[model samples]
Target: MSAVTELSIVLQHDIDEQYQYQPGEIIRGTIYVTLAKPTAIREITVKVYSEGNVSWKGPDEQVYQAQEVYVDSSKAIVDTTYDIEPLQLPQGRHDFPMDYILPENVPSSYIGKYGNVTYTMKATVVGANSRDTAISSEPFLVLRRQHIPVLAQQPLSMTASRRMLCSCSFGKLDIRVTLDRGGGVPGEDVFLQAELKNQSGHTVTAMQASLIMTTVFRAQSRSTEFRQVVSKKRDEMDVSRGEGRRWTHVRLPLPPYVPESKLEFCDIIELDYVFQFRVEMTGGSEVRLEAPFWVGAQPQGLEVPNNEQAGRRIHKGWTVRGSQALLFPDGGPGDGENGAGDSGGQQPHVEHDYDEGWGITLVPELRNASEVVTNPLYQHQQNHVTKGARDIPEELLENTKL
Candidate 1:
C-alpha cells in the first residue's frame, strides 16, 4: 500500500471517564481520522497494546529483567473490524464508533490497569495496503462503581490455600492464617494477619511466623528469581486449653512496580502469598502449615521477555524507552470544601531497600555498590523531593538501576 501524504487522529474528548460496571458492561468510544492524500486500503483494524518493565537482581547476581506488550488481539472488548472505503482525494474526517460487551468470564478485578487491573482504551486504524496502523491511546478512569451482587462477587474474597489438613498419627493440631484484601494495586499497602491454635492436647512452648511472596512462573524460569524477601518477624508465645495465638500485626508494602507490571496478562504474575507459622510443644510435637493467599494486579494478556528480538512488535508510535510510576490521589481529599489543604502536609513515602545482590547490573560503569532506590524513580541528590519523579526510560539500562 502507498503511504498517505498526511495522517491525523483525534479523540472525542480529552478524558473519557467510564464509571465502573460489572464485567459485562459495554465500553464505547469514537475516533476521527483525516488523510491529506488519497490512499488505497483494504480494511482498518483496531487494537490496544500495554507495556511494563521490571528490573531486579537474581540469585546469580545478574540483573533479572522482564517486559510485556500486547495488542488485545482477542479483541475481547470489541471484535468487528471496519472497512475503509477507498477515498480518491480530499479525505476530511471520518467517525469511528466502538461498542461491545466485556466478556462475562472476564473478572471485574482484572478490568482496570493496562496489564493487571487498570483499564486502558486504545483505538488502532490499520491501512489496507500501507504498513502503517494509526493508534489513539486512551486511559479510562472508573470513578463510580456499580454494586455487584454480593454472591456474584464472592470470588473476590475466596483465597487459594495450600494448607494440608493436620492428621498426625499421634495427635492433631489446628492452624489457620488469613490476609485481608488479598489483592491490591501496585503501590497500595497490604495488611496480613496470622491466627494459630494448638489443638493437639499439648501446651505450645514457642512459635515463629513469616510472610513471603512466591512467583508461580516467570519468563526466565529461574527458580532463584521466584522468591522475593518480603517482611519477616518472629514472636514468642505460650498457649493452653486449646489456646489461640495471634502474632504482632505486620504490613507488606507492595514494592513499586515499573508502571507496566501486571498480574493477569503474563504467565509469571502468579503470586502465592504465604503466611506461615511454626510451633513446638513439650510432648515432642511439631507441625507446620502454609496459608496461601492471592494478590491481584492490573490484567495484562501476556508478557514479552526483555530481548533484542522483541523490539519488532510495536512498529508504530515511538517506544520512548522509559519506566513510569503513577500514584493514585490517595483517593482522599485534603481539606474540607474543595479538598485542598491550605498548607502542604507530609507526603506519604515508602522506603524500598535494594540489596546489591538482588539484581545483576549490565553496565559496570554505573554505580558501584547496591542500594535501596526509593520510589518516584528520579535521582535524589539529597533526601528531599527536588523534582517531580517521572517514568524510567526503557532504552538506558545503565541508569535503570533498582
Candidate 2:
C-alpha cells in the first residue's frame, strides 16, 4: 500500500512570464509533494525535455514514425544512497527547487497534422511497490529569434508572357511582378510593383496576388506536401489592346501571426513561402508567375504585447519564428476578432489540447531520458494520399514552367 496522498510540480520564476523561456536561459521551478502519514520514499526525480515526433500511415496501411530529441535532462532530489535501507519522512509537505539551463540550439514549440515539437517539466515520486507512483507535468512555450535582414537582401521578381488570337491576333501580353524585398517579420508591410503590357487582341480583365505557404512531410519511403494560401488580394481593372498599366507601391501587409518560412530545425517537416501573381485576360487566356520569399523574424520587445509575449519569445514558435502557429488555429489570432472566422465562414476546424501527457510514471528508475509523448492536437489518424511534387525553385522564378 502507498501512503502518499498528493504529488505536484509547480513551475516558478518564468524567464519572461508564465513558463516562457529562450535559448541559453536558465529555468527555475519547484516541486511540491503532500503526504497523508509518515512514509519511507525510495527516490524523487524531476525532468525537463523537448522533442519532435511524426507518425503517419502510407497507401498500404503501413505506419511510418520518426522522432528527434532536442533537450533532455533529469535531476535527483532525494536519494537513499549512504544512509540506510529505509529513508523515512515524517510526512506533511516538502518542496524541492529546480534549476536547468536551456540549450542554445533548441527550436520553438509546435503541433502540426502529422508531427509535434513539445517542451515539458515532469516530476515523479516512488515507493517500495514501484507499481503505484505520483507524477506531475507542465508544458511551456518558447519563442525563437530570427534574422530578417539577411534573407531579404535582394528583391524577388518574376515574369510570364502569353499571346492570344481571340479578338484580332495582336502580340504577346507581358505580365511582370516584383517585391521590394523577399523577406519580413510578422505585422510588417511588404511593397509590390507590377507592369502589364497587353498587346494581345483580348482585353485584360483582372489581376490577383497571393502569399502562399507550403509544408512538406518526409519519411524513409516517400514524402508528402501540403500547400495553402495564407493571404491574398485582387484588383479588378480593364486594359485595351493598345493600352498598358503599371502599379507601384502596392502594400501587402504580413499578418502578425503568419507562419515563418523554411523550418530549418524540423527534419520530418519543411516549410517554404512564395508570392504568386495571376493575370486573367479576355478569351480565357491567363498568365501566372511565382516569386519565393521568407518569413523568419522576431520583433522587438517594445513592439510585442505584455501578456501574450511569452518571453516575445515564440520557440515551439522557433523552428521558423512562430512558424508552427500558422498550422494550428488556436495558437494565434486570425483575420476575425477572436481566433476563428477570419475570411469566410470556411475557417478550418481546430483541435484543442488538454492533459497532453496524462498518466502515471511508467518507469521509476532514472538514468533519465524522461518519456515519449504525443500532443493531443496532432493529426496522425487522418489518411494521407501521396502526390507528385512540383519543381520548386530556391531563388527568383524566371520561366513559365510552373
Candidate 2 local lDDT, residue 117:
73
Which 10 consecutive residues of model 2 have the lowest summed lDDT? 358-367
Off by over 4 Å in 1: 1-23, 32-34, 38-42, 47-95, 106-211, 217-225, 229-250, 254-271, 276-290, 296-402
Error of 1 at 271 (Å): 4.2
Worst 10 residues of 1 by lDDT: 393-402
lDDT of each residue in 277-369, candidate 2, tens digit only: 988877777788887778864532312223331222322210101122222344333324334434434544443321212121121111122
In model 1, how many backbone clashes occur?
36
Candidate 2 displacement at residue 121 in angstroms = 2.3
Q: Once superposed on the true structure, which residue ranges of model 2 sit more than 4 Å away at CA? A: 1-20, 34-41, 59-61, 81-95, 127-132, 143-146, 149-151, 167-174, 194-206, 234-261, 280-285, 298-402
Compare the candidates by TM-score and give the number of the best one. 2
Q: Model-by-model lDDT, in order?
A: 0.39, 0.62
lDDT of 1 by residue, 16-81 (tens): 222332232334456555665554444444444334444456657786555554324323122224
